[model samples]
Target: MSFKTKEKEAVGVPISESWEIDFQDDFDTFNTENWQDQRIWVNNETHCYVPDNKYGTREVSDGTLKLKVINTGAQKPCDNFDKNGVQHPDTQYVAGRITTKNKHEFIKGKWTARLRLSSNGEPSMFPAWWLLGAENNESPVQEANENVCWPLTGSGEIDIFEHHGDHQKNHYTTGAIKSLGECDKGDWWSLRKGFDVSLNEYHEYSVEWENSDLVYRVDAKEVYRNVGQGDQYPEKMFAILNFAKITDAPMKGEWVMEVAWVKHEFRK
Candidate 1:
């Protein structure tokens, strides 16, 4: 359980290239300069994404951001809509989802997030720290440039860490989403792979562009590699952290994913 600690402005030691920190947010009171609450629907998820700590979903306390999925015991109106332009119906469950979209975006470099789950894997919980193409034509489209659909036309995907609570307790999936060269199509399982880690303790999950490869890491160890898949994700991408209720399985209590920090760097 190696914690990244409070080195919020840390410029990590690099080998071949001198990496320079370009964007960072330590959750020191939820920096609006680096993030925004993103509400959108996809993946046929069960819960609705909410903003501003509603239902105690996105709380920043003690220098960490807690993304929680709370069962409200009643359905409520939701604003999240899908690509087909269908608004999410009233959902009894709600959770937090935030992104660096429209604020911080970068092309090929490195992305890192220090985080940990509050409990071991449980059915229906889906929490992820990942990157999305800036051109993704989802909800909250802030610009006309965001007209491209996901995993297509350089609107690619990269999962730094994604935990499916239905699986093994200390395991998570990571890697790229291979595009099918078509609209709204991406291969979710081909390039992705799962690995085990200390689920309830802080760890730095990261990815980097190493020439023609996309390297995935747990803390500092290379656990998986998407060989030569770097060419699929040349466009700028934004960071996202969210906790989702994916099924109708009864939630025991509070489900949380605590994030310490998120940052990006480029070779200098």
Candidate 2:
């Protein structure tokens, strides 16, 4: 689990000539100049293609997009946690989750998200910035391989910011490229210890994905970098922004995640 602390000299890869740089901008200055409103946003309605789960919503205030979810008086729904220990509850306890699904999708480029998140000291709460393949879905499959997806087949999945409430100072970040028929795969890495994450401050989580390599970073420091080669790597994917409370049953406390913005840029 190397943190990619070694600065290597610039290296290049060979790819199709059609691939070119798409977007390049500095959002640190704060301007709405080139930002495009996502095509899909959270609504009360349920759809077949989008996630209609209990705990996510999008709002607007002072020209900013605010996404939040908190547990209320609802009983926790079962079927939230899987065998791998991933929480997938049907009802939310005290958190919110959002994604740029129908609203936005990336084919291949450097994807960056600027966000602020917190466990808020509530147990079983996980906050993350992750991505999944749009083609990989749970609905009735049109074909066998047609429905197969990344984490499902161990294709290419990246978890940018994942925090457990039990540990407040550090978080876990992972990226893997599934191999050997989705069974054999790559590795994952956790961030350095003693990394203090303030509850209300903004930080940057980023992934630089190229032809056969992916790099994960936090606040400009590279934590994990995997140089992979194969078709399991994702050529395109979408982003998810969420802070969720995990409960075996619906119990309550305090947990929240605030996102400032998300940006993606590429240079060849």
Scored by TM-score, the top model is 1
Q: Model 1, which residues run further than 4 Å from truth?
A: 1-16
Residue 265, model 2: lDDT of 61
True-structure lDDT of candidate 1: 0.89
lDDT of 1 by residue, 1-268 (tens): 1243223225554343667899888888988888999888888888888877759999999999999999899889988998898988899889999999999999989999999999968999899999989998887789989988877954788999999989889899998989898887788998999988888999999999999999998887999999998887889999899999888889988899999999899987
Leading candidate by lDDT = 1
lDDT of each: 0.89, 0.49
TM-scores for every candidate against the unseen true structure: 0.93, 0.61
Prediction RMSDs, each to the true structure: 4.8, 9.1
In model 2, the runs with Cα more than 4 Å from the true position are 1-57, 62-64, 76-95, 118-121, 139-146, 150-155, 169-172, 177-196, 229-231, 249-253
